[model samples]
Target: MSENLGTMTDFSPDDSVMLKDVLRGLALPQKNIPSLYFYDQRGSELFDAITELPEYYPTRTEIGILERHGAEMAAALGPGVRLIELGSGSALKTELLLGRLEDPAAYVPVEISREHLLAAAARIAADFPDLEVMPVTADFTEPFDLPEPARRRVERNVAFFPGSTIGNFPRGMAADLLAATCREVGAGGAMLIGVDLVKDRATLERAYNDAAGVTAQFNLNLLVRLNRELGADFDVAAFRHQAVWDEDAARIEMRLVSTRAQRVQVAGRPFEFAAGEVLVTEYSHKYTPAVFRSLAEGAGFRVARTWTDPEGLFSVQLLEVPGAAQDSSGGT
Candidate 1:
C-alpha cells in the first residue's frame, strides 16, 4: 500500500472506499455510495472556496436574499425562539440570519464534523454574546432524534437549515427528514430552509464544475480520504471527476469515473473497478416552487412565506410546523 501525501490542491484519482461495507457496497454490481463522506476537513475547505467562485450563484444569491429579508423572517416567526440548524457548514451566510433573528434564546448547530461544529459554535458564542450555542454532531439524514440538550428547549423552536442541504436528499428522504424535524420541534415551531431553484443547464453545470478545477479536486479527494483513514491500496490516477446533468431526474450527478481498469484492496478486502466503472458520489436534485411546497405540506408543514433572489436562482422558505392542522390525511 502506497501512502499518498498531498492535499486536494494535488488531488488525483483513486478507487478506494470508506468503511469496509462502503467499499463492498460501491463495488457491488449496481450501487451508489454516498458522497457526503467526501466532506473531510480539506474537502470542507474546498467547498467553502467553491461557494466564493463568481460562477457559484447559489451561495451568494441565497445570502443576498437572506440579508435583505432575514429580519422579516424573524419578525414573521416572533421572538425568543430557539434556532436549530442542520448541517451548519461554515455558517458564513447564516450570520445574516443570526444577526437579524429576534433575539434567539439559544443557537443549536448540527454538523457531522466535530471540529467544525465546535469551531463554528465557539465563534458564534463569542460573536453573539447574548445567545447560547448548542452544537450537535450527527447525521441529519436518518431518523435519529435530537440530542438531550437540544430536546430541553421546549420553547418555540426555529430551524435554520441553510445551504442547499435539503437537495442532498432524494424527494422521499427529503420529505422524511423534514417531517422528522417537524416532529422533533413540535407544533408552533418553524423551519427556515434554503433550496436551490432549477435553472439553465449551462449555469448549473458551471457551478459544480468550476474552471479552476477546484470542484474536481473536491470530488476526487473522497478517495484520498478513504485511503488515508482506511487501510486501502488505491491508485490515485485511475479515476476522474464526472459531473453530469440528469435532465430526466432533474438533478446533477457528481461521480468519480474510473479512467482505467484497476484493482483495489480496502478495509481488509480486495475489489475491482472496470475501466469505465463509476462511483456515484452525490445527486443534487433541483426543485420547482410547486414541488417544494407540496413536499412541505406533505411533511406536515404549512408554507408560511419564502424569500427568493431577484433572479430566482435560490430560495429561503420559512415553514410553520403543523400550524392549524396535523391530523389531516396525507402520505405516511
Candidate 2:
C-alpha cells in the first residue's frame, strides 16, 4: 500500500466568477443557469437523496450494469491504466470497476464541488491503499491537468464518466466536451461512459419529477444557492419546479416557473420576472445507441462496446481512440 494520496488541482471558480456567470445567465433570453451550480453542499446532498427515490431509475440501473459487467469493462481497458472519472459524485459505482482492474496505475476523480470531491477521494484512498487517488476540484468541462502518479507508471488514460451526466449538456456542447476528453486522454486512451437512453415520455418525466419532491428540492436549490452565495434576493418560494419531456429534443427540461410577477436583486442588480416567465435550470438529453455512437464518432472516438440493462433504458459504452499502438499485454 502506497502512502501517496496524490495531488489536487484547485480550479474551482471564485465567488466573483460565479456571480458574473449567474448575472450573465439571468440576462439570457431563456433566463438560464448553468447546471453545475446545483452542486453546492446542500444541493449535492439533495441529489444523492433523489437518486434513492423510486422514480429515479438511472442511478440504480447504471449501478446494476456496472456491478454485473464491471470486470469486463475493466478487462477492456487492461492493466496499468490510469482511470479519470468526471463528476465523480460519491464515486459509488467507481469501486466496482476499480476493484476489478489489474494493476491500475491511478484513479483521478474530477469534480466541481471541493468538499464532495475531497470526501470521496479520501474514502477511495483509504479503501484502495495500493491505488493512487488524485482528485481534481474543478469543472470537468473545463481544461485541467491530470496529476501524475508518484509511485506507478501508467500505460494509458481511461476516463470513467458514469451517471449519464453527459446528458446534462446540449448536444453540441456534449460533443465538444467529448472531443476535449479524447484529446486529454491522448491517442491510445479510451473512455467508459454511461448514457441514458431515450425512453417513454412518462418514464422520462417521472424520473425528473419524482413523487418524493426531492428532485424538486434539488432543482429549486439552485435559487437557494444564488440567494445565499451571490446575495441574491430571489423569492424562492414564489417559484415552482417543473420538469417536462421534449419529444423534439429527446430531452427532459427542468425549469423554475415564477408563480407571480416578481423582481429579484443579485449583486445589487435588479431583474424582473413575469408571472409566467420560466428560468431554465437543466436539460437531460437521452439518446439511442446509433445517435450516441454518431455523437462520439464526431468527437474523435470510436464506439468499441456498449452494455445495457434488460430493458435498454440506459447504456454503458466503451469508447476508444482509433489506430493507436496497442500494449500486447493489456486487455483487448
Candidate 3:
C-alpha cells in the first residue's frame, strides 16, 4: 500500500454485527444473506476471478464500451470534476476513464472491504500520481461521507457506479440509492452507471453458472466466509450452487441449495435447513433503456446518454442531476 495515497480509511469491520447478520439470515423463513459479506480478502479475489471468466460478459462488455467512448464520456463530464465510484472493486475499468478525464481533481472509491479498498486505492494512486485517490470503507447501499479533500477541491462531482452493481439492489432500494447518490453528488453534478440489459434466459443463466464453476465458488465462498468469521459450522460440501433467471423479475438469482436435511450452528445458535432448501444469495436485475431511464428520472436525474455494445448485453448511462447544465440535445 502507498502511504502517499490521498486518504485510505482505517475502518475496522465489526465481527459481532456480521455474526448477527449471519444468524439472522439463517433463522429466516427463506434464508438469505447480504451479498456485501461476500468480499473478505479471499472472497474479493474469487470475485475478481469470476469477472475474468469468459462466461462473465458484463465486465468485458462494460470495459469495451468504456474503451470506445472514454474520451467522449470524459469530455461530456467536462474538466476538473471530482469522480466518486461506488462499489469500486479492483477499479480496473476506471483507469480507462481516468486517462481521458481532463485534469480530474479527485478520485473517491467507496468499497466495503477495507483491505481490498486500500490496496486498490494504493495502486490507483501509484498509477495516477497527480490524481487524489480516496477510498471510503462502507456499504455503498448506505450513506457514507466522502473524503473532505475530494469535496473541498472540486465544485462539480460525478458518481461513477460501474459494473452493473445497482442491479444487485431491489428496485425500490435501487431508486433510494440513486436518490442518495444524487444528494451526495449535489446540484450541477452527474452520475455515470452501468446496467445489464435484459437478455435471453439461457445466456443470462450461463453467465452466472460458468462451466469452470468459478461463479459457484464465488457463491459458496459466502458459506466459507460465515464459517470463518461468524463461527458458523456450515459443511461446504453439503450444499450446491445454483443460478436461475426469474423471467417476470428480469433478474438472475444465485442461491445455494442444500443437498440434504442439515443443521448448522452459528453464533451459538442452531439453525435448521430442510432438504432441498435454498439460501438466496444474490439477484442481478436486467433493465431495458426505457425502464432504466424511468429509474433515473425517478431519482431526480435525466438520462443524458446511454452506450452499449452492438449485442446490447450491457449499458452505460450518464445521468445529469436535475439542474446540471447539459448540451442542447439534452445529454452529452
Top candidate, metric TM-score: 2
**Per-model C-alpha lDDT, please?**
0.74, 0.89, 0.85
Model 2 CA deviation exceeding 4 Å by range? 325-332
lDDT per residue as tens, model 3, 246-287: 999989989999999999888789888899999999989999
Candidate 1: worst-modelled 10 consecutive residues by lDDT: 1-10
In candidate 3, position 68 carries an lDDT of 93
Please provide, for model 2 over 1-332, each residue's C-alpha lDDT reduced to its tens digit, 9 standing for 90 to 100: 23657767787788988888889999998899999999998888898899899999999999999999998998999989888999998898999999999999998888888888888898899989999998888888877777778777888789999999999999999999999988777778899999999999999999999888999999989999999999999988999999999999999999999999999999999999999999999999999999999999999999999999999999999999876734412211
Q: Which candidate is the best by lDDT?
A: 2
Ranking of candidates on lDDT, top first: 2, 3, 1
Clashing pairs in 1: 13-236
lDDT of 1 by residue, 1-332 (tens): 11111111111122342374476666778646676677778888888889899877888888898888988987886766767787787877667877887766666676666666666777777777666665666555543444222223335677788888888788898899888877766767778999888888998899888899888989878778878878677787788888878888888988888898888887777777888888787889889999999999998898889889888889999998855322211111
RMSD (Å) per prediction: 7.8, 3.0, 3.8
User: How would you order the candidates by TM-score, starting with the best?
Assistant: 2, 3, 1
> Which segments of candidate 3 are over 4 A away from where they belong?
1-4, 11-13, 150-152, 324-332
What's the alpha carbon RMSD for model 2?
3.0
lDDT of 3: 0.85
Which run of 10 residues does model 3 get worst, by summed lDDT?
A: 323-332
